[model samples]
Target: MQLKKALKSLVPPSLQARIRTWKAERAIAVFEAEWRESRRNAARIQVRRPIERILLVPPDPGTLMGALGDDAMVTSVVEMARARNPEVEIEVLTGRPVASEMAVAHGLKPVEIWESPHFVRDLDALLTKRRYDAVVALGADIMDAYHDFLGSAKMIAVVDLPARRGIPSSVLGFSFNARPNPRLAAHFAGVSPDVRFRLRDEISFERFGRFSPATSELVADSAFVLTPGAVADDLGAWIDAMHADGRKVIGINVHPMLFRDATDEQIATIVQRGADALLACAETARVAWLLLPHDYRGRLGDAVCLEPIRDRVAGILGDTVRHLDGRHRASTLKAVAGRLDGVVSGRMHLAIATLGMGVPALCATYQDKFEGLYRHFGLPDWLLLSPESFLVEGTFRDALARFIQQLPELTRIVGARREAVLALSRQNFTIFDDVAQTARIGSAGQGGSPAPVQDA
Candidate 1:
């Protein structure tokens, strides 16, 4: 590990990114070829009616703890499924033995993605034995090969195999970058028509339409349905105290990914300037700041990245600046976010949570996903900040001050579109229902036997 870190330190950030992209593209190409060949020989499947069993594949590998955004997606789907059918057996595919707290709380069974040495044979055996009524893949930005190419390929295979068998299958609401990986796009273009695809934003919908127009539909992200849970007593008390003191409370989420390309000195400089800016904004605006951490993936977590800035700001401002220093669930954090007047978040889900509560958010944009999210609130180009621009001195403070100034209007806009956004988010599950019903009709027409469908 030390040697690997040393080697990584020697390479420039731009070149490292290029190398990673090349590797992902090559692996995707190889996987696509093998997958196409397998589909050519695969037999069709027949699904039974009154959908009782569901197989949900999340974007993350192990427990749903790596990223809150991924966890919110899984949680929303499970909750919505149960609300529709209390007895629906929902099993989540995980790479680890243990499931997340949210999964256990929701009574979701965790099934290992790889249970044997033979990937294809094992999945086939499991599916045939379990006899699932439907298969849903949470394609949250991974289908584009920009995040995890291997995870994207695995999700596609899981959905494709079951889909070829005539079972209800869909890739749940997901996003595509401005320029998606060509190999991945081509692969989706040729996927079986029986598989349903839902895009979360206009940008992704417009881009995906060029390839799979017939299969893709525009829908809002499922995270919009996540309900707020209770906040920690201490955090709640702090917010109440701030309000009692006639101070406007603002929340901020900082992550290391925003500074992934910076040197150590550059990171320190950026953090120092960011703290100075926050202090300045607080002094002028009479705002008390809440340092919120959304992701908890070891070194990459927002908590690890925000500690230094938190210390610096708190040392000077005392109780006016506080850091939420513990492991908290996504819903709990959402509840805390709801108490804030506005939020500036490096993580998209944190922004989603705040906005869902009718609070204004300035998203620190990455991977081009935030544009569509902002569009959902009817305020495109109003509250967005690029990492490149944020790294410069004064940019962070300038953006924060401006965001604070526009909070009232932004909150009004978010409130006006809140119901519409929730309605669109509900459409994700409705699409699954529509496909399942259509599959049922098709099954009944053929005497409840597997329909003979051509392989892609």
Candidate 2:
């Protein structure tokens, strides 16, 4: 609309009107064609890297997978790695037990799941036991921990976290490559020397399933999963009200990462708010409750979708939601999102996955990323619990109502956002292609020298 308006300003009024009409139609066609070809090229680049033996370290289960998104990251990584090196071997190390089980279920060849306490020891054992050559740690885990624990791999890549913290120096220590956590990458530039910085924004999300069979199944089966268990004062009441309104609730059992390092009082405040939200939502509805703990004995009426995943991590839950097994985590979440009328929750990824799968989602967000994603898609009105507007009476419900009423608009906005995001993925793929080529050159250069194992 604006493009035509601008183009018409310089022409005669009668000619401008005609020009605007033609320009609008022509611009859309050109944009769409360019977008499609860009997506195809990006898909080729993501799988083009010959990642033959990769060890992926993922955030603990409850934490949102930044690089991985909703479908398991390890599964995507292994599949992409193998496609590059048909003989590629992939293994995953995760803090969350459920993540490990999900990785396997998602059909990542074979993996060894490790709790964080045992991360160092288990990593050493695996490194010694196999001929692993690469390591990929999701987001800031590479900066915070993995740099100290890397194996004798020739190359290591990290999905850069959002740059609000600072320029991540860790990427410089190895071959600095990045995924679309642009904020983190921006900060890292000021702090570290500019080496060959490879920005990998090209993400062929729609084509992800093509690279990994498990991802395809997960995408095909994804459903809405809601974790309304924020410690907000009215959570339980909200659940009860939703039930009264004829809503079918799916209980999500994951914990948030922001409060991971908070003080006890702060943590309690978040937990209580979560509990209130759950109680509100669960009371009026016969919610199909999915939990995380094996021993949770809560019976919110006759509706129970209990699928316990063993070796749980944190007990710092804000709300008292139930747990499902890791194996069923991906499928179950997908199933819930798919069947739901809609979702209103605090879980960021749950909402992200919901929108990605074409379901309308309302985020009761406590962080910038929540609003960031919605704003990224031009759906800022759908954000319920912005950091500035949380915990007020009826704020959550109003947001929920607004989202439900605007489902069609929300869906349209999400569709556009999906296309733009997928296009960004294609843009990033060009960088991945360059990096893969460079890595091969670096490997050849090193081949001139004897392969000597370096100690950390």
Candidate 3:
């Protein structure tokens, strides 16, 4: 009998399912083992460069949650670099407005800064400029698709390498997410000649071999800021439920500029509806207003706190949304998220931060990011309100009630997920030592000499 038939004949359906799952898991384990060994062999082959003058690039650093992980990656890189070699100069290629804001806040005084008028054109020029010793592609961007085209950099570090994308041998790959996407890593390893794909525990500069501490605190504190909000469809109903429950309602507006991209009517409609809702909800309790710090170009009514959100939003958007910048925002939204018995937010990062800090937040999402994070942590019961359905007041109230009821479970789940993420981060540390040693050897090989082994 054929192997497939023989296996099927020997096992019941349920037993077969378990066996198949086990076999798949075993294959992955073996693949990773072989891949790591191959990397070890490559590390021994001889590296020719000790990287310096690194550039950090990510997609859309100015948008709210779009830039959170990217900023963390950059911060980690800076910290790692400074620790490894304090004098190693660094530069950033980012959106102009966001770069300007980040410049003063973190020690991000880049030796060179490239502000892209168009992402593609500016990115090409920035990557083509004088040869750098290394380039660190921090986040998921189309530009990272062309890392090999960045001919000047001797060493390249990527956050994640998709399955079989054919990256060059010279680049070192690192998974940026808290956990490894083992299948993706394996596929990449199979394609690239000298790639070493490893599970990185902490998203850090030192962990990735840059070894700087210049921006560590920003990263460490990033996860604590998410405040959950309502789904787009159930906003009205959620308000009613809050009132019935005698809860104070905070209305947070965290989208792109309100009126600029919209026709006057569209802008007016949103404002009018928002104002009306605030008025209607005001009867139940007070309204605390929070706007995505950079989203307001024109000041709303007196209740809105535009300055702080604008300032921080300016840092992220750089100059693309320049007219929106003012006194930098520090997110008093945090104070709100901290004290609130519950939260409803459109901003996904805010939810992550808030939940991590033991706040119960309901997400009103229009995209995959919110749902992705929610599902990643197995909290499907929380609302994933769509734009159309979010207007319904009854739906909102029901969802809020359900969310409130599940508070205890939500806390446990968030706590468990946070632990898993931290544990994965801790596991990534070993990769750091491997890469650092590889660099030391690469440096010696470039000079055509065997490195002297120093007994530690």
Candidate 4:
């Protein structure tokens, strides 16, 4: 380590960055080569049976900072599955000890297979030992190489391994960027044909269909079916008071993704601008504001990033503005969101929660995922704010004002499509039925009654 540090100190910072980039590219190339070769040599296992046991792989392995969105997906899937078959056994794979607690809290059996360096080997052992009838990989917009390429590769492997083993594996509803990483896309294209890839939107479906059309299907995000949990008493009362005063309560979620690649000074400036925009909207519309934090992942969490902006908004707006000071589960946050008249959110899942509750949301988008979400409501251009433009002076304030003004129209549109969206969201779990059918067809008279499948 000392020798490497000394060598790095001898090179220019610019040169070091170039070297890192080159190394990453080389690593991706190597992974792709190995992946293609493995696909070519993979032997298919045919052990068809009823869907009694399921292994759920969440996007995050669970850390000090957990992803509420991923939790929402996992919880939603588990609830829907149990509602269908009360006797189905579900095991959630956890990487960290804390993740086990999360799984247990949701009444799931936690399987620790991520502590080992040989992740695939450990996963294989767990599958063999546990004999999971199905593997459901929750691909919540992290299966691409845009960030965390190795993580993306691991997610792919989670589904690929089970599918190849004829254990009925599938990636749950997910989104893809406009231009995905070529190597990752290539690897996805080569995965077992039986492994299903469910894209959350038409845009992502179109993108993935380019190479993996046979396995890819269009579905909605699983979080859409998440049930709302109770909110804090004080927060609930505050919102009630605001409603009693005839004020429109609006929720806002500011995310750290907006500060990606930004300097400290730029981040501070952005926060100040965001605060200014919120203040303007609050005063202009006489609206009560709730500062919601969706992600709680340490420094990158929305709560930490929103602190400065929240402070600023509260300093002036005082009682009219409230920041969620504690970390809450996705369901509880959804409950809080459901009470609001409308929302302006940087996090997609928070927006999903609000929209799922028949409330309007103006999404400040950091990725290509939000467009399809808004499209689901039939208002494709329904006040979609770009993060770059949100930083511009007066832009966010104007957008927020416009969103508030058009709330009734947007709300009507959202309500009109709410049932359709829910249906699509529930379709995310139909992979269970698909696999169960395959089992029945592949092993007719196998001497066991298949687990009953239910509508989501």
Model 2, residue 49: distance off in Å is 6.5
C-alpha local distance difference test of each model: 0.75, 0.37, 0.38, 0.75
Best by lDDT: 4
Where model 2 places Cα greater than 4 Å from the true spot, the runs are 1-51, 60-71, 82-87, 93-135, 140-327, 381-384, 387-390, 425-456
Task: Put down candidate 4 lDDT per residue, 178-279, tens digits, no spaces.
Answer: 766665654564455567777887777777766443367677889999999998889889999999998999888876677576567666766877788887
TM-score of 1: 0.84
Ranking by TM-score: 1, 4, 3, 2
Write model 2 residue lDDT over 167-280, tens digit each, in one string.
111111111122322222212222112112221211222222122111000011011222211222344454455557555544433233334344545433434444454455
Flag the better candidate by lDDT, 3 or 4.
4
Using all chains and alpha carbons, the TM-scores for the candidates as numbered come to: 0.84, 0.45, 0.47, 0.84
The C-alpha RMSD in Å for every predicted model, in order, reads 5.9, 20.9, 17.3, 6.8
Candidate 1 residue-wise lDDT, 1-456, digit = tens: 999999999999999999998876665555555565556666665554455788888877476546788878888887888776778898877676655444566688777753323445556667767878788888888887776656665676777777777677788888877766554544564556667677788778877776443366678888888988898788899899999998889998877677655566656765776688888898778789988989887767776557888888887789998888888878888899999999889898898888888888988887677998898888858478887665687888888898888887888999999899888788778634543434322110121222222222
Q: What is the lDDT of residue 435 in candidate 2?
A: 28
Give the local distance difference test score of model 4.
0.75
Q: Residues 1-456, candidate 3, lDDT per residue (tens digit)?
A: 599898778788899899877765554354334333332332121211333455544433343123443443344455555555577666655445656456546655442233222232333334344334444443332212232222111112221111112211222213232222222321332233223322122232232223211111102222332232333333344445555665544434334222234344443444444344433443343333333332233543211333333343445333222122233222433433544455555555456545555566676664333544554356674467654333444554455456656656776776677655434333322222232222322110121121221111
